[model samples]
Target chain A: MTNDHHIRTRLRDKIVGIAGCGGLGSNCAVALARVGVGRLVIADFDKVEVSNLNRQYFFADQVGMPKVTALRTNIHRIDKDIMVDSHELILNPDNIPEVFNDCDVIVEAFDSAEMKLMIVETVTEKMPGKPLVCGVGLAGWGENNDIGMKVFDNVYICGDHLREVSPDFPPIAPRVGIVANMEANQVLEILLGKMNDGNNTQ
Target chain B: MEITLNNRKETIPDGDITVADLIRFKNFTFRLLVTKVNGRLVKKEARDQVYIREGDDVTVLHLISGG
Candidate 1:
């Protein structure tokens, strides 16, 4: 079989899942939408608040709306043909598999440390073969270019993997957007078979 | 005991060390770490209960979530 090289049609059948709808999740979805990912399964149990506007892909009008729904609407604005399956509920180990089972890749964009750990651990354990692009240690502004990416077998982590968010260093826009798009880029690489497989990887 | 820690060879004086014990022994004070022993994920609650044997492959990733 021959490979499809056309940029627009290559991702026509790909399905990507986003596990959070906050800063990283929203921004990542937008980036993926722009790139024409076929389907996105997004889940979140929160609403878009006014404070989230500083770094999230939500507007003031969408403050009271559920993030998954709002993000879906926004993604449609970019490409109405792109299918978005939005789930508005708290995700746990039990429901995670059912929610994102068919997704080719999953993005972990949770804010709280517990949720981040839960999603990463769950996906890694249950979905052994699928790729999980995650964000960690992305805090503060562009004082330094410490944001980096870590590659494991099935897990790809983006960030410095150290700095924690605090009063002195809050999660800002540019750096967060960078990590979010990095995650989107990772998904593109995985789907396009650009990632280095375990072949001869000793 | 010798084991592969993050792809690097390391020696642990204790032959049998629990995941929690290893974390403490190594001073892994990071609140968020996704640990795996032999490609199997070990959650936070199970760290103390799970033991790392000789020649085990272990990975402990540091992470922070604000977005």
Candidate 2:
């Protein structure tokens, strides 16, 4: 197949499940839709707030709306042809397989440390064969440039080294966008089997 | 000398190396976000002058919230 055909065929009908429809999740959903990932499964139990307006793509009208629903709306607005399954709930062991069984990749976007760790550990255990890319530190205003992925076989963590001494940084969309897109790209690379260097490449 | 990292137990040279000294050696500046240490949470002011032991576990977690 030609290079163009190869790329298209690689992405066609691929299913990616995104956990957390906040900044990282929302932006990743949009990026995947634009990239023609075919179907997307996005989940989040929260809603957009006024504080999220600074960096999130959602508008004031969507402030009270469930993040999953709003993300579904955003994806639909971007590409109606894309199939998105939106879940307004948290991801846990009980539903991980059911929610992500058909997914080619899983994107973790939980904001809280405990939640992120829980999701990461649970997903890693439940779906050892599937690929996962988690979003990590995109904190601070002017100091968020290091975006990369840590690939351990099929599990990947994107962002910066998440240690307490790291810093008290804030989230910005442009910065989040960079890491989210990189996560999405890593998903694509995994699908293409070009993810051999997934770990240190970040 | 050894310094604690993310709370994971590591054997390092015993000395007065502070957490700041360890972070600098890693080429990590003062802007990255850290969330947890040794599987526990750490505050901002404790980033420096936190004396580490040879076998102490030090975990560093960054604050990551989406846009």
Candidate 3:
């Protein structure tokens, strides 16, 4: 195999923190680990449930396990050398900074609207200038083409930019994976200093 | 009378209009929405208090849960 020094040396040195180890967090963590991100800080207060198997990376056997711990095990299965910092604690505005202090880029992967807003607000307030990759509007089986990226200062929002979850429209695996992978790609792009202004890869 | 809504020039009533009013006027029914005026985030509670003037850029983003 040809050696890619840049990806092995530079990319592996970066640290990424993922908030909320649900579908987005779990999938994104695996993507990053496959690409060889040096360290990962994953925080989540919840445990794995059967419903999460639809999109989340955890398996059926992993149910009832704490999400952070389960995620760490999954990521290590991909890259045992990758450093994993798993925190099984709820992240609020008051403690976000402390939990994600060592991370270079923080990924907002919460499922609730209020929690998403709180993470964005708290991160922007306390960690000014830190890059944050966030996911929004990845509901339903809408056209995958609608999935896009939007950049605001240091915050990168990835999703279809429409279609909230409803009785008629639910969060399926295809759309969720598209958004999750977009978020993971953004983290890698930001780490490699390759991200530019405007939308990327609709 | 006119302001840029999501980068498209639109006309609103010739008077003060808050972000909440704009959201209603545009018929954005999404429960989870994020609004920013001129690149600054406007909290949900403050959307009613924050007014939009002419020539300002307004972006409204909808938040959803799948991943």
Candidate 4:
């Protein structure tokens, strides 16, 4: 393997806090671990359900496990040296301050609209300058609508925007994968300060 | 008067309205979350009262999923 000292030196010691450890969060966390993110704080108040086995990295044995714990197990399986701090509670007004305190960036990965808004509002109110890259509109069907990318300052929104217009696509794996990768790419860009807000890839 | 849904422009009567009012007028089901406006995601509590001005662009999204 080529010694990619640049990525290692840059990603080393950078702290990323993920708010939801479901499809997008779990995938992103694993990808970041592979690349060499110094520390990852994974928080999810949800437990693994039988349905999460499809796209998420959790195993069949971890079907009833807390998502954070399952995600930690998955990440360790990939890279045992990667440091992961698992929080077994939902992100809310009370504990958000400490959850985001040392994070260099925040990844919003919840599936519920309410939770997504909560984390965004909490971060905006508490840490305005901290950048957040989030995923949205990835539900439903069709490859044409499942991909989109946009960036604004520290905020990047990904996924499909068809919930209102097209009432067909239900949130699924293909949709989630395309959007999740977009989010992970944004995280890498932001970490390296290579993101230009004007770029919109849809 | 005109309004924009997501981003595409559309015709509408000229009036001051909140996002919730417009969404309700369209008979939209209250399910997907509205995270950012013009670029910022908003809290659920503020969604009802968030005022929409002329020529403003809004992006709404959800954060939860099983996968």
For this target, which candidate reaches the highest lDDT against the unseen true structure? Answer: 1
Cα TM-score per model: 0.91, 0.69, 0.84, 0.74
Candidate 3, pairs of clashing residues? A137-B64
What ordering of candidates by TM-score runs from best to worst?
1, 3, 4, 2
Order of the predicted models by DockQ, top scorer first? 1, 3, 4, 2
Model 1 C-alpha lDDT per residue in residues A5-102, reported as the tens digit of each score: 36457788999999999989999999999988999999999998888998999999998999999999999999999999999999998899999999
Ranking by lDDT: 1, 3, 4, 2
The parts of candidate 3 lying over 4 Å away from their true place are: A1-3, A195-202, B1-14, B54-57
Listed per model in order, the count of residue pairs whose N, CA or C atoms clash below 3 Å is 0, 37, 1, 16
Who is ahead in DockQ, 1 or 2? 1
Q: What DockQ do the predictions score, one after another?
A: 0.76, 0.17, 0.47, 0.27
Docking class of 2: incorrect
Which ten-residue region of model 2 chain A has the weakest summed lDDT? A161-170
Task: Give Cα-based local distance difference scores for all models.
Answer: 0.87, 0.69, 0.85, 0.73
For model 4, the superposed segments whose C-alpha errors exceed 4 Å read A1-3, A144-146, A164-168, A195-202, B1-67
Residue-by-residue lDDT tens digits, candidate 2, A1-202: 5555556556777899998887778887888888778899988888889988867768889989998888888888987988889888877778878988899889887766666666655665567657878777676544554656665445577876452213465676777777778888877777766645643233
Q: How does chain B of model 3 score on TM-score?
A: 0.93
lDDT for position A196 in model 2 = 56
lDDT (C-alpha) at residue B64 in model 1: 72
| lDDT per residue (tens digit) for residues B1-67 in model 3 | 8888776899988788899999999999877777888877788899999999989888886665555
